[model samples]
Target: MLSKKIKKLLNRQVNAEFYASNIYLQMCAWAEAEGLDGAAEFFRGHSLEEREHMDKIFNYMAECGAPVTIEEIPKPPSEYDNLMEVLKAAFKHEKKVTAMIKQIAKTAFEKEDYTTFNFIEWFIAEQHEEEVLFGKVLGKAEMLGFTGEPGQTLHIMDSYLKRLAAAH
Candidate 1:
């Protein structure tokens, strides 16, 4: 059984994941509108991944005998100045998610909720990968100066993103 505090935190995390998925979806739409097909595909795939993450937490909570509270998700912004801006926003959001996961893990440990703590271990590792993945992409975007425009640089970066998405 999950402690009330832990259950509440898990529910919050589930909502956060949902919000992240929507944000990614919005980014995908922006990328598509800008004609960055590769980036659009990548964001679209990531949006689904984020939904999976939310579902995983929801299932875990249910398995632990805690019924999740479904809450309202705020609308995500649809406008982005450019692809670089979109990547930067995504990287920033990932960092925020990583912090939230760490906080949940820390609270679980402090409360001696080993089951919850153990359950969160996978999320810890996932957040690490998420941050690293976003950071790597952001770094490459910075290096390439990807401006969401039609040019050789955009093609190169788009191809790179397509390959990156495929590799995962």
Candidate 2:
């Protein structure tokens, strides 16, 4: 059986994951509108990944016999000033998620809820990879100069992102 507090935390995390999916999808749309198809595809794939993340938690809660409460998905930012801003936002969101996971893990451990803590280990590792990936993207965007329309840097980045998307 799960504690009431952990149940609340997991439910909140579920909502956050859903919001992340929308965030990535919204960013994908913005990238497409800016003529960055590769980036858009990358974000599209990322959005699906977020949904999977949510499902993992939802299923885990169900298995634990805890009521999984899902909240309404919040609207994410639909526009960005530039590619840099978009990348930064992605990293920021991921970082926020990492913090949330860490805090919850701490609570889980304090409660001696090893099952919940063990389940969250995957999220902890995933968040590390996400942060590193997004950080690299931000660095690449800065190197390519993200202010204007399509350029050489964007072309290269598009190809790279396309490959990255294809890998998953």
RMSD of 1: 1.2
How high is the lDDT of residue 1 in model 2?
82
Give all TM-scores, in the order shown: 0.95, 0.93
Runs of candidate 2 exceeding 4 Å displacement: 145-149
Local accuracy of candidate 1 as per-residue lDDT tens digits, 102-156: 9999999999998888989999999999889988887787788777666887788
- The per-candidate count of clashes, in order, stands at 0, 0
Q: What overall lDDT goes with each candidate model?
A: 0.89, 0.88
* CA displacement after TM-score superposition, residue 109 of candidate 1 (Å): 0.4
TM-score attained by model 2: 0.93
